[model samples]
Target chain A: MVIDLDRCTGCEACVVACHSENNIGMSTPEEAARGRVNHWIRIDRYYEGQFPDIKVKYRPVLCQHCDEAPCEPVCPVNATYHNPEGLNVQVYNRCVGTFYCANNCPYTVRSFNWFDPKWPEPMQLQHNPDVSIRPGGVMEKCTFCIQRIKRVEDQADAAGRPVADGEVQPACVQSCPAEAMIFGDLNDPDSKVSRLAGDGRATKLMEELGTKPKVVYLEKAR
Target chain B: MKHLFLLLLSVALVVPCLRADQPILFPHSTHINKVHLKCIDCHISADTRDAATIPGVRKCMLCHAKIAADKPEIKKLAAIAASGREIPWQRVYGFEKAAAVKFRHGPHARHKVACATCHGDMPNAITAQPLVKHNMGTCISCHRQNNASDDCATCHY
Candidate 1:
């Protein structure tokens, strides 16, 4: 996914959409106060220049779905591994709740489920049946909206055609009101994501760390 | 309090037995053999919706309103329809909520898996009963057979 920071207003529509689509349970006020809150796609805001000449910039960060994902190697259960599609797939059932992946991650994007997700009454019915409701004691992170990826993949397979450009839009990309996020097959050179990644302004979140995350962010323009 | 606990425990133990005796004996044989209705006839969304939809009383009434209108079972269907409440049918096959399994019927139906593939010969069944365990292993083995992805996230996202 290529996030054009130039366009992001930090509306957090992507955040809200991810929670609903992925069945991410809510955290109480206490949990949030204790810093146990979960927001898979977080909008990191920073202010540049002091005093009245300040400028606030919002950078939306998610799992880079990195190629050289550090989390993959440390997993004793091989629960977190790189899939053929270059997506960092998390098998919740296989995860033994070891926080090694979270510790090793430079982005610190992965959130451990401190408790089983609870949705009272009709709120439970609002859950998207496509994605599994993650149970407690497992580390959860962004999977590029992998369930959405699988759905498109199955459709493409049935049609006997290559996944077209813009065929797969992760929840963040789909729900972004500002249209800041871009998702496509990176292997396809002609794809928008590839072209955006090739931009001079585009840079990895932590290039020095060498995680090689699939997500790239275009530098905010002056 | 002790008696209450014992009663609750007995009720919990007996619930499965009660479920075995379905509200209505579905008589899959009569529908398939005598009526010549396919499995998808009433379960119209079996190939489309996530779960093969259990037929509402309306779906049953579509045919029963005329054919076998006087049969005791048909009367039950009609009476249930008139009450404006859905049939209280227990689900015979499903993964637990915590298993985090998501099964779609469209892809499976498109793959041309027979009705008996996972469900056994439901047409010959007297009442709804799960033929396969639908465990992770059971699902994985089948995917292996078909050269489909058995990725944990495929079902257990």
Candidate 2:
């Protein structure tokens, strides 16, 4: 999904939805103070200019699911791999916690849980039944809702039909009230995501790194 | 031998206890059996991509205002609704952290997998406890048998 950074209000619905959907735990004030929080999708807030004319921007950073994912080749155990659906899938149980993928990620989108994540009793009840919980010591990242994708495909198959475009959307895209996140098959030129990816302002993070990220950020011309 | 057979049959019938430790002891049988309410009624969000989650107090009050206005639990629920505080529902069944699995409720529910499959006999449950132990092995085994993707990435991030 390409997020228009310019249009994002930083309302954080996507962040909250991501947390609820993916079970990403919040870091304690102590841990957050030290810059260690488990956020699969984070809004990168940047400050530009100074004093009176100061400006701010919010960019959501996540596992880019790069076509040439740097995290994939470096994993000794093959814990991290690219799925056919263009997802940089990470296998938590298979991850040996070598931190190789974390180091290799140019976007720095991966987060390590320093401690057993806690939701404080009933808060844990709010955990989404769909997503798995990552324990400490394993590396984890986004899968672009492979479970949902598979579910959609299964449903289509049960009905003896092909999976339709826009039939599946990740939580972030579904919850974005601004409709800022557009998710679709990039292979189809008619797909919303494919057309958006070709926008003049579209660019990948650290493109020089040559990761060929499926995620494209549409920059607003100032 | 006849006595032993009867004992084993009873154990098999009762071994899977109805009361597990769910966050909320949702009385599905009472709501479903007595009141004749549909599962989707209280869980209004189910039709969407998300699960049909526990309805908030307002939804409860929507009918309880007339249905069970005098009931103690309903009255208390009304008070909570008036206070604007959200219901603190505990999850009965879920994946633990470290698994890094994503399980969507809507898709499964839509697939005709009875709520009882994972939740286990919700119509009889008093408290939500672990009816099914979900591990990687169990999940993958079912997927493999059902011709589902057993790819580790299929469940994990």
Candidate 3:
């Protein structure tokens, strides 16, 4: 996943999209006060200079899906681990809710389910059936929408062909009105995400941490 | 020794009675053996789609309309078809939502995996029952044998 900060308008379509697509539990006022809101992807706002000469910057942050993820080793139950496809998969069933992985995360993207997810009357019908409604006592973050990836992969495999570049779009990437995010196979040199990764302005968040995050953030070209 | 034998005999007799009857006893044996119908004949999407969907009342009425029209079960099915409401067939085999197992029938069917492999002996039975227990172990063992992916994300998102 490559996010172009230059294109981001801070509209937060990705945040809304993620909530709807992932069946993330809605946070009550009491939960929100305790800082227990669930957001798989969140836009971080930074204001430079004083009010008169202010400039706002929005950085959409999610699970970096680090190759050498700090969260993986800390998991006692092996609930969180890097899959063969290079995704940091958090198996909900296996999770014992130790919160060790959540503590070790540099990005602070992982959110714990404080209570069971509840959807009001009609809202229940809107849930995406592909993604599991994660129960309480499990830590969940962005999966890079693994369900979407698997669905495309399955369809491609059925047709006896490889998954095409730009075929697998995470909810955030698909819903971005500015087309700020790009998701594809980073291993494929010709892929758009790979191309963006090699761009002069592209930089990984907290690269010095040695996490080797797959997401590349393109600096706002001033 | 005599009391133990009596207790065992009562349990054996009562267990069969405990099994709930289906809304309509649509016999798979009669359809498969007598009419020579394949699994896919009724379950049209078995090879092409994720769900091996149970055919609606219309599909049942297609054959039951002319053959055994006098039968009580057929008359009930015909009434359902006439009312344009789907027969509420109870699912025999399925994973719980929490399991998050996205079991697609298309791939298995296309791979030439016999229907009896997961769904045990449907052709010989009167009504469908969960004869084979479908758990993670069962899926993993088969995948390992076929050199298929045992990756957690492959089925569970």
Candidate 4:
């Protein structure tokens, strides 16, 4: 995934899209006040300067899906691990409510299910059937929309062809009105994501941590 | 010894009563053997979709409108078709939501796997019943033999 900071308007379409696509539980007003809102992708706001000369910057953050993931090793149950496709997968059934992985993660993206997810009346009907409604006591975060990836892969496999570039778009990438995010095979040299990763302004979120995150962020133009 | 015999007797008596009675006793043997209707003729989506859906009363009425119009079951089916209500057929095989198994019939059907492999000989049975037990082990074994993906995400999302 390549994110162009210059294009982001901080409208948060990606946040809403991620919630609906992943069947993320809604947080009530009381829960929200307590910082219990479950947002798989959230826009982090940074204010530079103060009083009349203020400038605001927005960075959309989610699971970085690190190559040397700190979360993977800390998971005692092996509930979280890197898959063959390079996705950091969380198996809800295998999870035993251990918060070790959440603690180790530098991005702080993993959220614990404090209560059983409930949807009032008609809201339950809106859930995406592809994503599981994670039960309480499990830790979940961004999967890069593995369900969507699987669907496209399955179709390609059935047709006896490789998944074309730009064929697999995560919910966040698809819903971004500004087209701020690009998702594709980073290994493919000609892929948009791969080309963007080689851009002069592209930088990793926290290069000092040595996490080797797959998401590349382009610097906001000065 | 007497108590053990009584317990065994009770289990034997109760086991056969477990199968729920359908709204209509659909005669699978008669339809397949005598009429020579293929399974996909009624389960239209089996070869191209996730669900091998149960045919609605309208599909049943297509032939029953003339062939067995006088039969009691046919009359009941026709009445359902006229009322424009579904038959409320009970599912004979399905995984629980908690299992998160997304079983698609299309790929399996296209692979040339016989319907009888998972469903058993449904055409020879008098009525629809769960003739085969489907568990993760059964699916894994089959996949292993066929050199198909046994990845956990393949079925469970």
Candidate 5:
């Protein structure tokens, strides 16, 4: 997935959609105060220049799902690993909560729950039946919506047709009001994501890390 | 001594029996079993990446609009639809906040494990049971036995 920072309105629709779809835990007011919100995809709010000329930038941040992910190597239990489809998949049951993967992540996208997340009686009804509610303590990060991708792939495979570019949008990408997020194969130059990634302003976050993240971010427009 | 023994046995059986009652009588048999509605019919989001969805009143109204027109239970759906209030259902199963497991049901369901294997016979079930253990041990063993990836981080956030 590639994000066009230029078009991001930072309305936070993507964040809310992801929370609802993925069953992301809600942090108590206290937990949020301590910076412990369990947001798989977060908009990195950045500020630049002096007040008169100051500019605010919102960059949606999550696991890069890198080709050479640093977290995958440091995992003592192999809780983190790369998949064939360029996803850095996380298996929750296998996680021992050692947090080695969290520490090793260059993007710091991984979040650990310190308490049992709760939803009041009726609110729980809204819980998505398709995603598991994560227990506290295990480390987690973005999987590029691996479940969604797998479903689309399986459907496509069954039909004997190749997966279409816009067919399987992740929650964030699908919910973006401005349609700033594009997801598709980077390997296919004809794909929208690939074309966007190749744009002159596109750059990988923390290129110095050499993690080779599949996610590409377009520079903020002046 | 016999009375005391009987008392102890009664408490052991009765006390826990009360706890076993679901917070709400969800009557899965009526909604799923007798009607033969798919589990995903009400929890429609399950077909996608979500789980345990509390369907909107409009969704319920589509059926209750005809099936139970004169019933009190049906009125609740109408009230909710009029007020645009989402029916809030308490979550039965989910990861403890500390476990941080990112368990997506779409992939698992897509992999040929019928919903009944994990959710039990919900269509015929009158009450919801904790049919699937969902503990780490249960999960890990299944994954290992099936050659599914057992990495701890796989499900953990």
Candidate 6:
């Protein structure tokens, strides 16, 4: 996935879309106030310069699907593992809720379900059938929409062809109103994600940490 | 001492056989053998969908309405259908909700696994029974045997 920081307006359509598509529960008033709101994808806002010359930057952060994910090794139950497709996938059932994954994560992308997800009447109807509604006390992070990936792979396999570039799009990528996000097969040189990764402006979060997150961020082009 | 041991052994054998019978008398002996109805005839979505769904009352009525319509069980089914209700069929085989395992019958059926593979031999079953304990190890071993992916994400989302 490639995110162009220059294009983001901080409108947060991607955040709303992620919650809706993934069946993430709305935080209660109490939980929200406690800074315990559950969000798989979030914008990290930072203000640059002093009051007279200040600019706000919004960088969307989620599970990097890191090549050397700190969360994966810390998991005692092996609930979260790096898939062959390079996704850092989490199995909610296997997760024992140690929260060790969340703790070890440099990006702090993993979130724990505090209670059984509650949807107000009609809200339940909006939940996606493909993504399993996570149970309480399970640590869940962004899967980069593994269900969508699998569906595309299944279709490609049935047709005896390789998955096409831009075939799989995570909910957040498709929902970005600014068209700031891009998702594709990073392995393919001609793919948009691969191209963006090689851009001069492209960099990753906390590069010194060497987590090697698949998500590449393009800094604001001033 | 010998008499007590013999009686205890007989009771243990009898108890399991009695308990193994399902609540409903959906005998394969009658449905598959004498009647010769296929599994998919009742399990409508077995070949197509994620779930091998059970037949609704109407499916049962297709044959039961004319054949042995006077039987008490058939009458009950007819009444339920007339009242616009689905049969409260308890799950005979399933993973627990917390296990979060997604088992699609369509893929397994496409792989040419007979219903008896994981479910055990049901050709002579008197009623539905959860004969096989579907755990991760069991699934992984079978996938290994078939050279299928044993990826954690394959079954668990």
- Candidate 1: pairs in clash: none
lDDT of model 2 at position A213 = 82
By the lDDT metric, which is better: model 5 or model 6?
A: 6
lDDT of 4 by residue, A1-222 (tens): 999988898999999999889999988899889977787889999899997999888899999989999999989998888888888888887889889998899998998888988766688899997788888888889989988898787688779899999999999999999999999998899999999999998999887899999999998557
Report the lDDT tens digits of candidate 6 across residue range B74-153.
78778888989887766777767777777777778867888888877566665676667777788899999999998889
Give, for candidate 1 chain B, the lowest lDDT window spanning 10 residues: B13-22
TM-scores of all predicted structures: 0.91, 0.64, 0.93, 0.90, 0.63, 0.86
- Each candidate structure's count of clashing pairs: 0, 21, 0, 0, 45, 0
Q: Write the per-residue lDDT of candidate 3 for residues A1-222, one digit (tens) a residue.
A: 999999999999999999999999888888889989898999999999998999999999999999999999999998889889899999887888999999999999999998888776788889987788888888999999987887798799899999999999999999999999999999899999999999999999999999999999999557
Best-to-worst TM-score order: 3, 1, 4, 6, 2, 5
Q: Between candidates 2 and 5, name the one with more favorable TM-score.
A: 2
The DockQ of each candidate is 0.50, 0.33, 0.57, 0.39, 0.26, 0.51
RMSD in angstroms between candidate 5 and the native structure over all alpha carbons: 8.0
Interface root-mean-square deviation (Å) of every model: 1.5, 3.4, 1.5, 2.0, 5.0, 1.4
The alpha-carbon lDDT assigned to residue B50 of candidate 5 equals 35
Query: Could you tell me which 10 consecutive residues in candidate 1 chain A have the lowest summed lDDT?
Result: A116-125
Tens-digit lDDT string for candidate 1 (B1-157): 9999999999985553334467776788789999998888888888765678888888888888999888887788788899998989877888877676788887898889877889887666677877556777777888999998876777767
Query: What is each predicted model's overall lDDT from 0 to 1?
Result: 0.84, 0.76, 0.89, 0.86, 0.76, 0.83
- Lowest lDDT sum, 10 consecutive residues, model 2 chain A, at A113-122
User: Candidate 2 lDDT, tens digit per residue, A1-222?
Assistant: 788887887888987887788778778888888988788888889999997999988888878888888888999999988766667788877888899989988888888877666775677988766566777887777777766777787678657798887889888889988887888888889888899999999988888888888888999677
Candidate with best DockQ: 3
Docking level of model 1: medium
In model 1, the Cα lDDT at residue B54 comes to 85
Report the error of model 2 at residue A186, Å.
0.7
Predicted candidate 6 versus true structure: per-residue lDDT over A80-165, tens digit per residue: 88988788999898888999999999998888888888876799888886778888999888888887787787667656789999
Task: Give the per-residue lDDT of model 5 (tens digit) for A58-144.
Answer: 889988888899998888887778766567887775678888888888888998867655765666789865466767777767777
| Model 5 per-residue lDDT tens digits across residues B10-128 | 99855533343543345677876577778787777565553546666678788877886777656765776788777655565776754555566655766666777677656655545
Measured on C-alpha atoms, candidate 1 has an lDDT of: 0.84
Residue lDDT tens for model 2, B64-95: 77886787666766777788987677775566
In order of DockQ, best first, we have 3, 6, 1, 4, 2, 5
